[model samples]
Target chain A: MTKTSAGKPFPWHILFFLGPGLLIYFSVSVYPLLDTLRLSFFHESSDGSLAFAGLANFTKLLFDVVWSEPFWNATWNNLVFFFIHMLVQNPIGLLLAVLLSSPKLRLSGTYRTLIFMPTMLSVVIIGFVWQLLLSPLWGITENFMWNLGLEDYFDAWLGKESSALVTLAFISVWQFVGIPMMLIYAALLSIPDELSDASVVDGANPWQAFFYIKLPLILPTIGMVSILTFVANFNAFELVYTIKGALAGPNYSTDIMGTLFYRTFFGFQLQEGSLTMGAAVATLMFLVILLGVALYLFFFQRRIKRFQL
Target chain B: MKNTQMQKATKTIATLAAGFALASTSFSAFSADKLVIESWRAEDTKIWSDIIIPAFNKSNPDIEVVFAPVPTSSYDSALNAKLKAGTAGDLITCRPFDVSLSLYNKGNLTSLNDLPGLASFSDVARSAWITDDGKNTFCLPMASVIHGYIYNKEIFKELKLEVPKTESDFFKVLATIKSESRYTPLVMGTADQWEAATMGYQNFGPNYWKGEQGRKNVISGQEKLSDSQYVKTFEHLAKWAPYMGRSYQSQKYSDSQNLFTLGRGAIYPAGSWEINGFNAQADFEFGAFYPPVPEGQDTCYISDHTDIAMGLNANSKNKKSAKVFLNWMASSEFAELYSNQLPGFFSLSKHAIDLKDPVAQEFLSWRGQCKQTIRNSYQILSRGEPNLENVLWNTSVGVLNGTMTPKEAADKTQASLVNWYKPQQ
Candidate 1:
């Protein structure tokens, strides 16, 4: 009656609140991403001049023997690294989460805190710590294994080309398994007790109840965890860098996209930095990540729907 | 009463304004003379801050020196970022060889060819810091690092062995040590990729590659790394691998040094920079020797490349003060102080202080006796390629692991070089 419903002006206060955040987001994240994408098209001349080279950098990265060899090796290694996490890390995490979520489990709070402690620490620090523990020179692990009468099983896992990447992946997984554990734990806790009771009352055993009632509910979280693992694994650098160095040594067996990106971008030893090529690598990494996320959303994520509990 | 209050307030305000104006003027005048140097060696922070700057101030009291120490791992990238952003220090510690050349070509460095200090350095010392054209001196050559093996004197004495001068003799010594089983024959921390290349191949590469002449040949496309000489270097490295102890690949750079200092190993291949650390840490006496050459070669070629060189930032507002610092750095007094502070860094200054440490003195004796002091292969290799250090080191790793033959390793390295150089041709 007083025209109050039709007369309210646009919320300038909301714009004011969002403006600074949007500006920061654009500058810090979006702008740099776009700029990197743009830089991938150019090449740095010997005299330090930048000239447009279009897709030449990309082409060279994929086709040229020198660049392509390392590129493919890193790509394949990165995928292997991601798969290791998927196969080993996630299952261990899910088990720990399930066990911790049990009603009969004592000291669950302390266990959760203790288990998550590694994730709280820096990855570089963890990598170094593991390196020392596993070092053949110091014989710390060897001594422990000797005490256990398993000395013959001890090997320089970090040194072997076949074992280095997997060993590093395990180290990474050990440090980060806590993340998925907490995530899955939260998802499990959100499941109502009544649902479990309902399944049990219907003559389902504990295992059957868990399988039919709880597993279906936690599927969505597992999907999310999978996506997160994919992203983190592909983007990882520090662990390999700290343990294996820039060359990702033992003949570059442990090299991942992040280290390759770093080597190309900053140069190592005798190689000069090539900004354009580095940008191209970074752009590819971005596209790979995007493709992964899109596939998750359209395929796996869509199939796993969240149900109200 | 209001008028009197107003007068009093205005007087107080004027006094405060005058005080602030004077304070700011003096501050600007003081800050204007300050010079900042960005150095990669964090270990030198104390020497620079506590002694060097104070000593420099004695000569030029008006100028202040600020030491900005960056860790070696990220120094080049950090410096590059600073230079690109126009925020680089007045004086910059240039990384040796290609990194310095790259910076100079980018016009980030100022030429110091006209500096009077340039004349004092010997031709060999001056050559380490000059441009490819040999006309422009982009940085002031400070000290040259000698690369060789640092051996436990006690172990050598106890084992009844002398410093081996020939390759066969070296192998025989290693064999004796291995047979004794009391210590590792050679302590190599190949887990760190640079160590294998730095202490192993690069140190020995010159002996076979033929020093400056080999460099010229490679650069001129007349020779490749796969050539018999370089291939033999890898083969020799492979032969030496068994003596490096089981799980040598898990040994870090520090681990090798630790093993050497603790008398766990007979020989540790390292550079001159290890002298101070070894002296401080080792309970046993240690001596340095060049890596052995072939059976007939009389002299072992040591890597005598410039260790740390100082360059003036082209965009620096305090270039005059920076040049003063560089001039002081090039002086005999400065060299004496530097050598005394960090022994074993052989100063390029004409009046370098005689190193008093027995180990350093031993290294100096080699420098005097050696027929040729060649640049390390890492220093001489082309920067246009994938790092030769990485290629050589990776290939060396393959040899060590028995995954690839020495010939294959050499061929792979040559292929990398050809891949890089062929495009340019």
Candidate 2:
């Protein structure tokens, strides 16, 4: 629109438009992240002063028995948590998206709204709701099992060290599945009607059409969904904190990086708050999430080609 | 004639203005002595807003008190940040031992030695607030919480079970309760990990470890928790595990409390802080008793720990007014009112307040009978060490779940302490 701008000096309006947003982004997001990284290199002295410790905090987190044990435990639990979401949540979300995207489906909008309802509620509220439903003293879940003639199978899964993490992961999956469903459904809706008709004309059945045509087209969206899930699963804290508390009880079985970071930052029970160690934990979390996003971008995104439509 | 009238009017206006300024100055002076107190007990807003503040105002009407309450979970961190920033309240509520020590060491709290009310506190209460050098006191000890088993008196009477005095008798009582189809022997809310360590292990440990001397030995590294004395505590805990049932792990603190209040459980092991909540909620009458020791042991020790303490902030501008409030808080009148208001909490002062609550009276009856009282291990352990509460909770859960023996659990806890232990410089 302004050919004269091509011949003019450097544009001022461009910066004028972008300045406020960039400034806000730097102050709120980038600055704090960098500051947290800087703080991770320090340690809190007994006198309540900050002293430079280089990589000592990281070394302790990775090697020292007291710190490393819980660190590794949380890291492992987080991986299991992420894997469960991948194995269970995304697939179910995909199935629901496929069903909801069907032509002439009755009450399709209503079903979509109902399915997405949980995602709209706060994670802490969802955590407490599930906690109440699963509570043994209340016997709600047990009574439901009794009605279904599966009373013997009912156990306090949320309390056992072996099952606590998995139970929490499933709860997270239940609340967040709607997100992937909506994203995939939007991607499915973007497909052209002519393309599906052409696939059918080529003797492809509905299943084959979905597999060869629709699935391939939505691979890019799925890749995006995978990375989103990776970031979210790694950063999760509220649900675990709400239910298992800061200790992530039953011998820290439900402990994840988020809860560990919170405990290290705030101090729980008898532990004194160590801001430097908390920053170190947070820095490690950032590096992990960054590495995951980098891997997804470099490898997964490169393999999945986006269709023109 | 006009000039004379103008002069009279000017004089009258000046007199009125002077009177108004004097009244405003007096008003400012009267309201100037405002004090702020911050605490973690948000639920106790009524106690402060209704009774304590009103009573304090009666004595010091010129001083206005503002109560700032934070949720317990995040209170320590919030207070620590505020203290570091030199913006905390004039009077601050602090956790008993380590947290108080840390704040005192950092010079965030003022010395309370000069307060005349310091004379009223007992040696034990004074000892909890005194520094290691014994030259200064940092806070006024407000109340001591006693931990024990709160059992349904109705259930015990219905079953014809005598109040247990020995470990064998306690187990027999559990067995008798287990024989009943309707009642659970014990209800524990281990979901909140601190409960296992605080209510279960700490309450039971002193009985076997022989109280203060044993704790001092552990602190001095003269003995380890893996030793027979401490291992027996874990063993006793494990012995009581089966009675908690299969679903015990999932039971939250609130759930366990509900079960006990609803008459579904015979016994709920908790602290004196729960007394008010239980009394208000329970339909049936309940009572508390100290956890039993081994049969040969004649004395059982109660875990008596300072529940809450208040200190004058070093940064407070209204130090004189805050001192007046603290003095009142430590007075005999405050003690009587405190015991009446929060019925189960024992007053730490020399003045005796006749406790009306039967549960409070029962706990008091154990005072002379026990050999000695010991604070919770986490309270006595050195600050900056990896949390013993978390370590004990993990090991205790392992012992209860049959994943580890008492010896193994004890050894693991010892190992954790050793890993995090640093010699005092």
Question: TM-score: which candidate is best?
Answer: 1
After TM-score superposition, what is the CA distance of residue A47 in candidate 2 from its true location, in Å?
1.9
User: lDDT for each of the candidates?
Assistant: 0.85, 0.85
The runs of at least 3 residues in candidate 2 whose Cα sits more than 4 Å from the true structure, single-residue gaps closed, are A1-10, B1-34, B84-87, B379-385, B422-425
True contacts kept of 2: 0.66
Docking level of model 2: acceptable
What C-alpha lDDT does candidate 2 achieve relative to the native structure?
0.85
What TM-score does each prediction get for chain A alone?
A: 0.96, 0.96
- Docking level of model 1: medium
* Consecutive 10-residue window with the lowest summed lDDT within model 1 chain A: A1-10
Please give, for residues B38-156, the per-residue lDDT of candidate 1 as tens digits.
Answer: 88888778888999889989999999899998877667767777887888888988767778887888898999987888877887777766788888889898887788889988889
Cα lDDT of model 2 by residue, B62-133, tens digit: 889989988787788788778877779899986777778778877888999899988888777877777777
Off by over 4 Å in 1: A1-6, B1-30, B376-380, B422-425
